[model samples]
Target: MAPNVLSIAGTDPSGGAGIQADLKAFSANGAYGMSVITALVAQTTTGVVRVQEVAPDFVTDQLVTLLDDVRVDAVKIGMLANAEIIRAVVEVLDRYSPRHVVLDPVMVAKSGDRLLAPEAVGALREQLLPRVDLITPNLPEAADLLGEPEITDVEQMPAQAERLSALGAKQVLLKGGHFDGGDSVDLLHGDGVSEFLGSERVETTNDHGTGCTLSAAIAALRPQRSGWPEAVREAKLYLTEALRASERLEVGRGHGPVHHFHTWW
Candidate 1:
């Protein structure tokens, strides 16, 4: 059967990021996509203007309702807007114990608007991190978790990935996109293996939902692959092609989205 993947995230009405990107990535990866929106974000490719969060009880209801029916194979978690929502997600994961959980530590948008509340960071660490199979954090998000300003170089990623792994995740995929270089390298550390996946950086301002896309694709690929490393590798390749195709599309005034359906046509 195709992987049954769920995205627990916010909504980007402009269709560039959040659940929109996740669902598209899931479909492109040949997975059955599902979603539970944590918040309704008012934004385009330009920036996040405002946000309306869903009630925690409703979020729990959504999770229970879905888990009651669908046979979820993997889950992609993004943008939990508050501590309550984080707790709600934790509760569901504890109950169902999905096969794979891809946690995207989505703290901020590509435009620098904060997606997660500052206070909720602690809740996420305590409640969600331990339950996830893989935690994918960009340099800035990793820095936030580690109480550092930012991870400045690729050399530091291994140590940070190790630190994050120690925090309870089974694996860590530290994305090195912010590094000043020609290639975007990612470090995957866990399961007695440390590997780096690198791809030539595609020059484009339209890289909005790359993080969400990568994590969701990984979740979609997780159940089908032999191991987490192969899932990460395939996701990276898919995202690279998506980025290359995204460079040509004109979507908005500011940073646009990577083409999640790039492989389709």
Candidate 2:
């Protein structure tokens, strides 16, 4: 049977990022996908205009109901807007102890709109980080987590990844997309092993949901019993291909999304 994957995140009515992107990436990667929406985002590829966060107790109810009935293999966590939602998530994660937990730490949107509340950062770092198996944070997110203003190059990724791992994450994939360069290099650090996964950069504005897609793909494929390194590599390759194909898809006027089913058609 395919691994059952769950995405706990906000909703993207535009279908480019958040729970929509996660579910697409999960199904495209051969996992049975499920979702629990934490917020309803009214946005397009252009920008996020508004957000409606779900009640914290309701969030717990959804998690409890799902875990009680479904056989979940892995979880991809994203866009927990506030401390209440973060605490709700932390509670269930402690209760069920899901096998694989991939944390995306979605603080800001592709359009530069803030997704996570500034007040929630402490709760997220304190209560949630310790439970996750892997954290896939882009450079900006890493810098925020580490209290650094910026991370400018590939050279800083290893040290940053190590520091993030010390924060209780079992592993860290520090993405270097925000760094200006010809090649996009990502560092995977965990268990006294740090490896680099580099690929030629695909320049395209249609890369809105790349982070969500990569983390979700990792969650879907991790159930294959592959190591974190292998899962990260595969997910990168998948994202690269998706980005390469996404240029042909003109979904929105501004930043469009990568093709989640690039391999299929």
Candidate 3:
């Protein structure tokens, strides 16, 4: 049977990011996909217009009810909008103890809109980081979590990744996508070891949901793979291919989306 992967995230009515992209990535990677929405975002390939956060109690109810019936093999956590929702999620995670948890620290949108509340950063860094099996943070998100300036040099990534791991994340995948480079690089630090995962940078503006897709793909592949290293490696390869094929999609005018189903369509 395919592993059951659940995405706890916000909604992207545009079908390019958030819950939509997560489900697509999960299914494309051969996992059974499910979702529990955290926010309803008025967004498109161009930008986020407005956001309506779900109530914390309701979010908790959704988790509890779903976990009560479904055997969730893995979970991919995205945009939890505020501190209360973060705490609510932590409580349930501690209770059920899902086998695998991959957190994509979604702090900002591809269009430069803030997704996570500023006050909630402390809650996410101090409370939620320690609980997850893996954390995937892009350069800015990692800097935000550490209360430091965004890293500009690739050489600085290892140290920054180490600092993020010190915050209690079992594993940290520090993404270096923002920097100008021939190859997009990410550092995976865990268990006192670090490995650099790199792929030729695909030149495309249609990369709106790359982070969400990569982390969800990792969660989807984790159950079938041997360990974090294997899962991340395969996931990066998948994202690279998706990016390479993104131009085939004509979703919207701005930063579109990677072709999650490139294998088929």
Candidate 4:
């Protein structure tokens, strides 16, 4: 049976990220996609201009209603606006107990507008990190989680990944896209063991929604029971190809989304 993957995140109207991206990623892997909206964002490739959070009770209701019925194979969590919402998600996880969980700690957008609250960071690490099978954090988010300002060198990523594990995460994927170089290297760090995944960074300003896409892909495919490192590595390759295929399709004035339908069109 194909895996059923659930995504809990806000909606991005542009269809480039958030629930839309999650769904696209889900479909790319031929898995069923389920979603619970945490909030709604007024956003574009430029930045997030406004956000209206979903009611905490409503969020809980959606989760409970879904979990009580379907047998979710995997769960991918993104963009819970506040600590209360985070707590609500944790409660549901504890109750239903999905076999595979992927957490993409989406703190800020690629354009630098905050997607998660600074005050809620502690709740995320303390309450939610331990529940997940893998937590995907880019450099800035990793720094915030580790309480450090700089993770400039690629060599330091293993230590930071260890720090994330110490904070209750079973495994962490420290994305190295923001690092300076022609090549992109992502560190899959867990138990103080590090595996590096790399690709020649695509030369395009249209990269958007990559984190959401990659994590959702993993969640959708994970119940094949692949290891975390293998899942991440495969998803990275898929995302890179999507990036290359979408480089020329500048749909918007700002950063554009990946060509998720490249296989078809």
Candidate 5:
């Protein structure tokens, strides 16, 4: 049977991110993808205007119903709008114990709109971070995880990645896209080692939903026999190529979506 990955995330009407992006990434990479929505985000390229969270019990029901029927090889967790949803998902993870879990600490949208609640940050750190197989955080999100206001230097990202691992993530992928430079480098810290993945920075304002895409790609690749490191590297390569192809595409007036089918058959 083919491998299967699950994405516990939100709904994006624009179809640019959340469960939609996760499923697309999985299918794009030849894996089956499933989802349990945590929230319904009213959003567009310009920004997020409002959010409606799914009830915690209903969220649990979705996970339970799916896990009961199929075996999940990996899971990608996205927006948990509140503490209740965080706890609810944690319970399911505790019970079913998916083989691979990717945690993307989605605190805010690229447009500077808050996505996760302030209080749920604590719940995420305390309850969810330790359980997942891998945690992916960009520079700003890394700072939030450590409760530090800023990561002044790109060199400091590795140390912060270690700190995040100590906080209970089996491994950490600390992305360096938010760094101040013309080059974008993403660091993957795992098993007491750090691997820096670099690519030429594509200068464009169409970087919305990057975190969601990256996390989803990682999850989609996670269930392959290649293991986590190779999975992440492949995902990063895909994202880089997509960004290169789409940077010039004028899809929207605001931050544009990635050209996913740039190499479509």
Candidate 6:
């Protein structure tokens, strides 16, 4: 049976990131996808223009209503617009602990637009960080979470991953994509393990939604694979292929989306 994976996130009507990318990645990785929308974002492949947040109570209603019936095997969390919504999500997570939760700290977009609010950072770090199974944060997001400067070197990743793990996430995948390198590397730490996962960098302008896609793929593959390491390895391979095949798609003028259906289409 395919795992029933839920994506709690904001929207990207352009279909490159957020809930759109999540659902695509979920299905591509062999999971049945579900969604609870947290925000209505007016965005294109180029940038986010406007964001209208869903009410906090309604967000709770969406989660409770869905979890009451469906058997959710894993969850991928993306852009929660504010602290109120984060608290609402945390409350429901406590009530019905999903088997696996992957948090992609979506602080900024590919176009350099800020998605998460400044005030909500503290709420996410203090309240929600401890509740998730794995958190996938790129260098900038990790620095923001820890209130430290962004790391410039790969050697700095392990210590940062460890610090993030100490915040109570069972595991942390600290991404090194921002660094200039031949390979995109990530440090996975926690559960008494520290390993670096790397892939050959595919140079392309159409690399939008990589974070959302990667995290969603991990959530989708987690229940089927043996463990986090296996799931992450497979997911990274999927994203790399997607990046390599992105030029096959011509979506928007700016950083376009990765090809989620690279294997099929």
Model 3 segments more than 4 A misplaced:
none
Q: Residue 156: error of model 3 in Å?
A: 1.0
TM-score for all models, in order of appearance: 0.98, 0.98, 0.99, 0.97, 0.96, 0.99
Q: Measured by TM-score, how close is model 2 to the native structure?
A: 0.98
Candidate 1 residue-wise lDDT at 179 = 92
User: Per-model C-alpha lDDT, please?
Assistant: 0.92, 0.92, 0.95, 0.88, 0.85, 0.95
Best by lDDT: 3
**lDDT by residue (tens digit), candidate 5, 191-222:** 98899888778877777677888888888877
Measured with C-alpha atoms, the lDDT of residue 38 in candidate 4 is 97
Judging by TM-score, tell me the better candidate of 3 and 4.
Answer: 3
Residue-by-residue lDDT tens digits, candidate 3, 26-107:
9999999999999999999999999999999999999999999999999999999999999999999999999889999999
Q: Model 1: what TM-score?
A: 0.98
At residue 43, give the lDDT of candidate 6: 94
Error of 2 at 118 (Å): 0.5
Model 1 residue pairs with clashes? none
Task: Tell me the lDDT of model 3 at 245.
Answer: 95
In model 6, where is the ten-residue run with the lowest total lDDT? 185-194
Candidate 2 lDDT, tens digit per residue, 26-135? 99999999999999999999999999999999999999999999999999999999999999999999999999999999999988999999888889888999999999
Clashing pairs in 6: none
